[model samples]
Every structure is written in structure tokens, then in C-alpha cells.
Target: MLTDHHTHLAPDDDPLDEEALSIERIVAHVTAAMDRGLAAVAVTEHIYRFRVAKPAWAHPYWETQTQWDIDAYWEALSEAKAIGFPLLVGIECDWLPTGQEVLVEALRGRPWDLILGSIHWVDEGAVDYDLYSAFDHIDSEALWRGYVDRYARAALSGQFDVMTHADLPKSFGPLPSPATLGWAYDAIADALAAGGVCLEVSTAGLRKAARELYPSRALLERCNQRGVPIVLSSDAHAPADIARDFELAVEAAVAAGYSEVQQLKGRDRRPVPIG
Candidate 1:
């Protein structure tokens, strides 16, 4: 079965509004995913985009972006799910060193199908966005190292079901040689296997300046060798983007020796044969 567990209802460039969480919009995404022959899809919006999740992060960028109500977001998704929509209710949770406790408290007791752990920000600067790029304040090598360390910690935190876009540090462009980061990949694979967290093989990177899939084929092979299960995602921010470039994602997974992908629901996962 083909499934996409990482998807965003709201665009990253825009602050989420009421229209973004409407039942109509949610169904549109699901329908698009189904049209692409996806057996399942999950609407895992960024937690920082919700007003209630603001206390979990101290970044100024989050302050300006967190304006929508999380309750309404959930209510809409639940309504869609209640009516038998073929979608999962999930959230893409960011891993912040100082806000770990607050983030944990914020996500407790919710009916989450999956929680995708991501390391978008390394300290106060964003890794992918140029407006608050971490490269502006830190050197490329330091940023890469910091991102790897944070990702390892996030995977071991045991708070998420899957880790998305493992190589986000290179989203904007190329970095130092992979030889310099080989140890980081090994460490990440080990942490993910130890934590029992599945690694997301996302096609979103194909759309980024990196022009390659997230986590690279080398990292995917490392994770596969460590027995870290995988999930496929497009990281879609719009209905039309659902399952975008999934052929390449599947090819990459097969090339990495992944014959199965995980399907998630109510925080539990089951393996499905990859096509």
C-alpha cells in the first residue's frame, strides 16, 4: 500500500487562517491523495502554526506565525475522520531544546494518529528559510553539526512516531563533504533505531534547492542497515501537492533496500509492502 504520512494543510509562507482548516479543504487534500492512488494520507500540519502551541517555542518567527486555533484545527479533522475520511490526524512537532517540557505538555492527551518530529530550527534561526537562516548567524559546519545533534536527541526523546527530512541542513544548498558527516548519519541511524522512531523518506527535498530527496540515498541506507523503518511523504502544503514526486521517493526507498513502508493510526504503526 502507498501512504503519505506527512502533509500540511497550510502553506509555510502564510499564517494559517480559518479557511485552511475547513472540512472542505481537508477533504480536498484527501481526495487529491486518493486520486494519486495513495491508500492513505495524513494531515500533519506544523504544531507551531497553532496558537496553543506557541508556548512550546520561543522563536520570534513562531510568534508571528502562530495565530490559528489548534482546537478548531482538530475539530475539523475529527469531523472529517468521523465521517469516514481516509486520512489520519497528525501533527509535525518541532524539537526545541529549551521547549521540550512545554511541548510535551502541549501535545498530551490529544487524539494523534502520528506525530512527525522535525528539527527545522537550530537555536533561534531557521534552517531552510532564508529570512531567518541559521547560516546567517552560524557557519555551515556548525549548523550541520548542531542540526545532527538535535535530530539525534529528538529521535531518542521518544515523543514522536517518525522523523521527517533528516538532512534538512542541506535544504538550501550543498554543504561540506558527506565524508565529514558520515559519523553524523551513523549516529542518527543508531538513535532512531534505539528510539524505535521511523525515518520519513520525503520527496519535499526534491522541490528544495538541494534538488534531492531528504536524507539522501546514503542516509537512507544507513537507517535501513540499522533497522530503522521508513515512511514515505511528499510534505505537501497544498491539496495539489499530495503524493507529488512519489515515484522518485519509491525508487529511492527501493534503492535503499526498503521493501516496506509504515502505515500509522492512533499512534500505532504497521508495515505495508512497498510498491
Candidate 2:
């Protein structure tokens, strides 16, 4: 079955940023996914609602999106479902150092199909956007080690359903060195298994400079060894991008010895046969 588990939708004129999405554009994107032969897709819009960052006056745009109401999210979900398209409601929640209980309570008893836990901003408010851009100057090994450490912490916190992308920094630019990041893959895999979290093989990596998945082949091998389940997501921002490189991801999964992949149905995970 062909499915893309990560998609974002926004008005045509909206900026190419997370906060620019709208419900009207989301429905359009969902229709596009159905037309493009996607059996199912998750509408995982960005919901990084943390009170940590103090936006400067220069970045006034950041302040406009400080609050993302869950009630509004479900309303959009209801509207999308009325269109008779197979769409799932999910959010890419940020894993903050504090507010674990608040986050859990906010999501409690919600009809969400999936939850993606990601570490976008570190404690010191260092976003990966800056972290990846300064790769050459910084110690690449130490940076990657820090990323893995954060991933473990994100998983162990018991807040997210899937580890969104293990090697997310690679999305920004060329990876500094493989040895450091490669060594941490096993820890991430083990963490996923222990925390009952799945890994998302995002196709955005192929569109990156490296033209390979984020974690690469060696990391997939470690995931296989640890028996960690996986899910495939296109991380599509527009309609045409839905399921963009899913076939290649399926091939990669099979090569990694995973015969089945995961999906969500009413907050419960169900394995779908991958052929």
C-alpha cells in the first residue's frame, strides 16, 4: 500500500514556513493525496507551542504563532473528514525540557491518529537552523552526539509516538562527518524500542543535498537489529509532494529487513504489510 504519513498544507500565498498553513489549503492537499494514489496520509502540521523563546522585535512573525489551539485542530479534522477523504489528524509536538505533564494532559483522550515528537529547539533556544548552518565551524562530532542525546531524551520522556527523523540536521546541509552520527544510531534505535516509539523514514532527506535518507543505510541496519518498527512519511509541504518518494523508501525498508510498517488508527498503532 502507498501511504504518506507527513503532510503540510497552506494557502497558496502563504510563506514557506510552518505557521502559514490553513484549513482550506489542508483540505485541498488531502484531496490531492487521494488523487495521487496515496492510500492514507497524516496531516501532521507543526504545533510548537512552547513559552521558551522570547522573540525579538525583528522577528515579530514568530510571536503571531505562539498559540495553537487543539480545538481548532479537531475542527479542521472534522471538516477534512466530511470531504470523504482518508485523512488522519496529527501534530508535530516539540519535546521541551519542562511541560511534559502539561503536554501529556493536553493530548489526553484526543482522537489523534498519530503524534510526532521532535526536538526542534534545545534548552538554550538553539534551533537546528543555526546549528546546521554553522556545521563547518563547530565540532561536527560533538554536535551529532548532542543530537543523538536529545533524541534519546525525547523518546524516554514518553510524550511522542514516533521519532520524527533521526538525522534531521542533514536536511539543512551536508553532514560534517559520518562517524559521530553513525555511532549514535544504535542508541536511537534502542531508545525507540524501549520507549515504544517508531522511527519515521522521511523522504525529505532524498531532496536534501546528500540524496539519501537521513539516517542512511547503516542506521537502518541498526534499526533492523533492534527490531524497531518504522513508518514512512513524505513530509510534503504541497499537494504534488504527497508520496513523492514513497516507492524508494519502501525499497529501503525492505532492504533493511522490515517487512511491515506502522500506521495509526484512533491513537492505536497498527502494522501494515509492506510489499
Candidate 3:
């Protein structure tokens, strides 16, 4: 059965963006998953956008980033769940170095079906955006090294169930040398194997500059070699985006010799065989 483990609603409360914040949108999102033949879908908004998670975010944008009362998100999610839609609640939480207890405490006893560990930023700059857009400014090899090192640490932290986008640095442009990329993948695979964290295979990269799945072929192959579990996702932010490019994601998994994909219900993970 198809399962989309990552999704979001309104990025911000833009009055112009009513469709995203409406109950109609959440229902449509669930219907989209149904249309895609999904058995389950998770509405995993960014934890940094909610005031309850503010203490966990360690970015300069903390002061200026869009902050909304998280209760509205829960209300919408619960409404969708009550309708008997196969939707589940989740959050994409950053695995920052500090205040991890705060992040955990903020989410304690919440009805989360999954907690995706993510690395959206490295230091203060966004690794996938600013660093990726201007690859010439930084040492590509050094950047790759640093990101992988931190990713390994995040996986080993035991704070998340699934590690989101293991090879996110490849999203923009300017990749590291083949040797550097190989070693980084090795490190990530080793760390994931040790931590027992499921890897997220996101289709969003197809729409990004990467023009491929979140983890490239080489990295996925590494996971396969290490027998690391994997989860499939579209990383949808709107109804129309649910299960986007999912066929391609499955094809990539097949290419990596993976025949089973992971399904998450809360922290419990089950493997669904791919046909």
C-alpha cells in the first residue's frame, strides 16, 4: 500500500492562502492520497513554525520566522482523522545540537504518528538553499564532509524515528568529488545502520534542482547494502502535491534492490513489500 509520511499545510497564515488552511484542503489532501491508492498519509508540518517548538529552533529566523499557534494545526489534523480518512499526525522536527530535551518535552504525549528527524540548516545557513545555490562560495568537499558528519550525529542521537533526506546536499548544484561523495555515503550508511533509523525516500527532490529522489542512487544502494529500512514520501505541502512523483520514487528503490518500503504508525514501523 502507498504511504506518504511527510506533508504540510499552510506555510504561513496568509489571508490570500485560505485554501491551504481550510478544512477543504485537508480533506482534499486525504482524498488525494486515497486517489493515489495510499493506505496511510501523515500530515507532518515543520516543528519550527509552531511557537511550542520555538525553543528547539536555533536559527536566526527564530525571531522573524512565521510563528503560529500550533493548536490550529492539531485541530485540522484531528478533524481529518475523525472523518475516518487514513491520515496520521506527525512533525518534521529539526535535530539541532541544543535544546533537544526541549523539543522532546514540547512534543511529549502529543498524538504524533511519526517524528521525522531533519537537517534543514547547517550552522545558520540553509544547506539546501543558500549553500546549494551558491556552491562556489564554499569548499564543496568540506561542505559535504560537514553535512554528512552532522547527519551521522543526528541519526545516532536517537531523537527521531526516520531520518529525512539523507543526501540533502545534492539538492541544488555543485556536488563534491566522486571520492568525497563516496566516503560521505559510507559514513551515513554506517551511522544509519548503527542507529536503526529508517531512511526517508522523498520525491520532493524530483521537483527540486536535484531532479532525482532525495537520496541519489549511490546512497540508496549503500542503505541496501547495510539493510537500512526506508520510508517513501512525497513531502507534499498542498492537496495537489500528495504522492507526487511516487512512481519514480518506487522505481528508484527498485533500482537500489529494495523490495520493501516502510510504513509508520506512530513510532511502530512495518515493512510493505513493493511489487
**Candidate 3 segments whose C-alpha is farther than 4 A from its true place:** 11-21, 131-137
After TM-score superposition, the amount by which residue 47's alpha carbon in candidate 3 deviates from its true location, in angstroms, is 0.5
Tens-place lDDT per residue, model 3, 122-222, is: 55556766523335456678778778878999899887889998888887557899999999999999999999999999998888888888898999999
Kindly list the per-residue Cα lDDT of model 2 for residues 1-275, writing each as its tens digit.
66677776642224433344456676677778888777778887666432322222123333544444556666767576667768888877766656556566666777788888887644343334553244545455655666677888998877777788777766554455656666777788888888888888888788866678856877887887888888888878778888887888889999999999987756677888986
Clashes of each: 0, 0, 1
Better of 2 and 3 by lDDT: 3
Q: Each prediction's Cα lDDT score?
A: 0.87, 0.70, 0.81
Number of the predicted model whose lDDT against the real structure is largest? 1
lDDT of 3 at 170: 86
lDDT comparing candidate 2 with the true structure? 0.70
Ranking by lDDT: 1, 3, 2
Is candidate 1 or 2 superior in lDDT?
1
**Residue 268 accuracy (lDDT) in model 2:** 74
User: Which 10 consecutive positions of candidate 1 have the poorest summed lDDT?
Assistant: 171-180
The better candidate by lDDT, 1 or 3, is: 1
* Tens-digit lDDT string for candidate 1 (1-275): 68899999878877567788777788789899989998889988888887877877667888877777888888889888899889899999988888678778878888899999999988888888889888889887778888888999999999999999998888764585666578778888999999999999999988888899988888999998988999899999988878999889888988999889888899998998876
